[model samples]
Target chain A: MEESPTIYEQIRTSGYSRRDFLKFCAWVTAFMGIEASGIGNVVRAMETKHRLPVVWFHFQECTCCSESFLRSSHPIVAEIILDKLSLAYTETLQAAAGYQAEEVLYNTMKKYKGEYLMLVEGSVPTDNDGVYCCIAGKTSLDIVKEAAEGAKAIISWGSCASNGCIQAANPNPTGATPIHKIIKNKPIINVPGCPPIGEVMAGVIVYLLTFDRIPELDGMGRPKAFYSRRIHDTCYRRPNYDAGLFVESFDDESARKGYCLYKMGCKGPVTYNACAVTKWNNGVSYPIKSGHPCIGCSEENFWDNGPFYQHLASFPGFGIETTADDIGLAVGAVTVAGIAAHAVRANIKKRKLINADIEESKKEGGE
Target chain B: MEDQKIKRVYVWEIPVRIYHWLNALVVVTLAVTGYLIGNPLAIQSSAEAYLGYWFGTVRFIHFVAAFIFFFNFLFRIYWGFAGNKYADWKNFIPYTKKYIRECYDVLKLDILHIKVKPFISVGHNALAGLTYFLTFLAFLFQSITGFGMYSAMSDSFFPKLFAWVVPFLGGDFAVRQWHHLMMWFFIIFAVVHVYIVFYHDYVERRGVLSSMAGGWKFIEKDKPT
Candidate 1:
């Protein structure tokens, strides 16, 4: 295999000072929740290890994952991260296009077979031979299967790739399927979110490059360092939730006071991500911090979970679409009414039976 | 002569009566607190957020009641095997042909109101026993969903065992929705159960309500049923 420039050498050639390179390492290491001692190791690894070749692919997605990755909280993301990786091919960022782009993809696969990382954005559509999404006349199913055949590990970049995002919501017409579902043999990491926090995307890539192995994963195959805890668990507004102080609506007085957004259909309690702690846009604020409920963008089938402003989800079955409370109340009321009617009829029947028994006893005594 | 002849039968033992009452209490506790945890009341106090821990207290009550309910259910399972014939396992499970017939007979008499003769059951009637068996399954459902959500907040091994249920059901939202709906099941069950007990009490004069409290039910000595 051809040797690639180390991250430090590439960064220096790209006009980044050595101090800037080390600073990026420390920032990413801290974001990964690694101890202070781990920062030095990260720097040493990046300075010596050759650039890891990556073949990033896009399928049925909104390109927001790429947007989030390139515009990570740090300024060096586009410069170092994109430039540092010996990126063989990426539809979004690669300078090549058309047939030339296709050639790069094949050459990288052939040259770095079993060595390069396969980073996927969005989901693959398999219905009708994967015609829903086609890149250069080849269906996503064909491309993904071909690309994933020899990769060491697959990093699914967002809810689109990890859990099929909006495309795989209820009544999915395209049969959009996530990466892990299709590529069963390879090690997969699911970084699920509408567009997972920018820093988190960077952290996942950094963790893999530094250690040359996948990070610890949760039951959902997400990196545990960032996806283990629910936003509610570490939320600054948790005290308000515990106190039963909640925003009833968008313009309510409770909302003005910055009480918990749970009553307004905030799904922080159910969604697992680093948004509450890591914040977004370089620690500026997250959805809850900005007066909007979480909407559970990070969880699977978040779009189908329910309305964005309702606390309860719309139960899926039974042709009638309604909240649990609506159905529960209706069923409960009907049952009570049935009981009332049954009690009235039962009482009448009991009285009639009792009078008949009394008459029979009197006749027996007279006889 | 038939109306004058009567027999007092020992139906429920002390253990069965205690289990019944305890289960009733636990169900009420769990349903109320579980509902509140899902749709908490907006009690905005003027005091600081830390000063009011009402929601936390509601959740704590739910957890405590849930544990009690789970253990109470387990105890009832044990009693189904060990208790007297009236409380035996055979009655709860409608396996035999006779038990299935009893269900039909009771349904005709109580619900259809077409059967003139009253169906007599020394213990729970087959239909009611069958309903209770279904309720037990609902009980198990609530426990599974309850523990699954609890696993996220707790590090204990007991709750951890149910962690698999979270992803299995598609995560926290689905589990909470299901658990909340089951609370309504218990509510409806309680309403119907109480009405049936009263209706039978008036018709039979067999002390159906008192039987639960005193372990005795009055039966007719002449009738074979």
Candidate 2:
């Protein structure tokens, strides 16, 4: 950590002006939802602060989070933080290999003890003695537990690391578990998505480095600045949802007209992410912008929620696939039928009892 | 009939009666709107999106009714403590051995048909009381899930209180599933509840069904020895 240059030194060496660095600081400050006064503090901290060491661990993941991070939307993110963070050891980006790579990872673990930030990219598989996912003969579960012990704090880079994304979906064969489930002591910031938006990924890191503390988190341990509002709240097609103008199918005219994808199971209503606002691929277009429904990748157990192509008419729960209305109509019909049967029997039985009482009264009166 | 004397008993108090009817209306409204929300009507119009706020209006009605339902439930809870002896809190819970026995007795008569007559209680029978208590628990569940989902849409502190439920229950989808399923619970409860009330009115010759409306139940007096 001490050997690396501060972010300010990196900018100075790159021949960028003080104004450029100030602008960068202000941009991150705004993303953090900090007041205008906080920009100065961010600048002061960045100029004096030593480059924080980061260890990015990849396990049962697709490396999309790394892709999103490297291709971050922010103009300065790819250039500044990428170079400034002093990535001590990352499986995907590092050039070293074999024992040399393993040696760097171990040395960083020792030298940066209680100081290095650990960014976990995926879940740790724990089934069958963690045989499902192994790296260099060590199970993900064992490696993560060992690596987590000396970390300053942990950042779950995507839904894979946050809530056991797809691998930990229903009937999870690998017994894949998220980092938080395995490491309880460290403060974890879960930036969840199939792959979180590039800007959001960059924002989390910038917030951590600038503030030297985790940002305000929501109940889900996600940064409140990005995850507090559902995608529906900020969606541009919101008027269409509110108007009930929806695309019934992908080939429908409404699809060309840009109607809301909600009817086609757009999970934008339930999904919390910066995708709607930030957009993907340098704010060019997102899946929703291209007429595809949001899959709610950021949410927990999203894969098991239901089919992505269908709306909320049905879901799998109660040990069977059924909907509320289907069960309601069936139970209602049966209950009415049963009641009709009960009424006839009850009336007939009551008549007999009443007549018997009348006869007994007559006998008593005659006596 | 000629040898019997009848007495009129005031069982349901005015507040309790009002709460009952209001709750029924709100529950019906909520169920209908809630179902539609889960499965939108798919009304396709060539008109611009601004021309129709049909779905928005439906949601507005639901939110308003939800607020009314929530407050009405709170009022009933207060009435349970403040109202007359028949509408007292003690009746809702099976607090004693006798209460449980009466529930079993009502079950035997109404359900098993082992007895030929209706179980008589000026207020709700023990079985109905206990069942209604369970629905109250369902009411709590629905409110939590309802407001929990609403928290995402609104920034109000009241709704925000239930925000933790989303993550706790896995997510919005799981919460919505439970909320939707519970709607059927109320509907089924209403079906059986109405039937039993009418069945009692017929069998017992008491104003059981009308008692909820007019607050009077005709009780047969002691027979001449």
Task: Provide backbone clash counts, one per model.
Answer: 0, 0
Q: At residue A310, what lDDT does model 2 achieve?
A: 65
Please give, for residues A1-367, the per-residue lDDT of candidate 1 as tens digits.
5677888888888888888888899999999999999999899888888878899998889899888777787877776567778788999888999999999999999988999899999999989989999999999999999999999899998999998999999899999999999999999999999899889988988898889889999888999999989999999999999899988878988988999999889999999999999998879999999999999987988999878888888777854448787888899899988888887877676668888878977997898
lDDT of 2 by residue, A169-205 (tens): 8899999999989899999999999899878888788
lDDT of 1 at B22: 91
Candidate No. with top TM-score:
1
Candidate 2 chain A has its poorest 10 consecutive residues by lDDT at A312-321
Q: Using DockQ as the measure, which candidate wins?
A: 1
Tell me how each candidate scores on DockQ against the true complex.
0.75, 0.63
The TM-score each candidate achieves on chain A is 0.94, 0.91
For the predicted complex of model 1, DockQ is 0.75
- CAPRI level of candidate 1: medium
For all predicted structures, in order, the TM-scores are 0.95, 0.93
Quantify all predictions' global Cα lDDT against the true fold: 0.88, 0.86
Worst 10 residues of 1 chain A by lDDT: A314-323
TM-score of 2: 0.93
Off by over 4 Å in 1: A317-321, A357-367, B1-4, B116-119
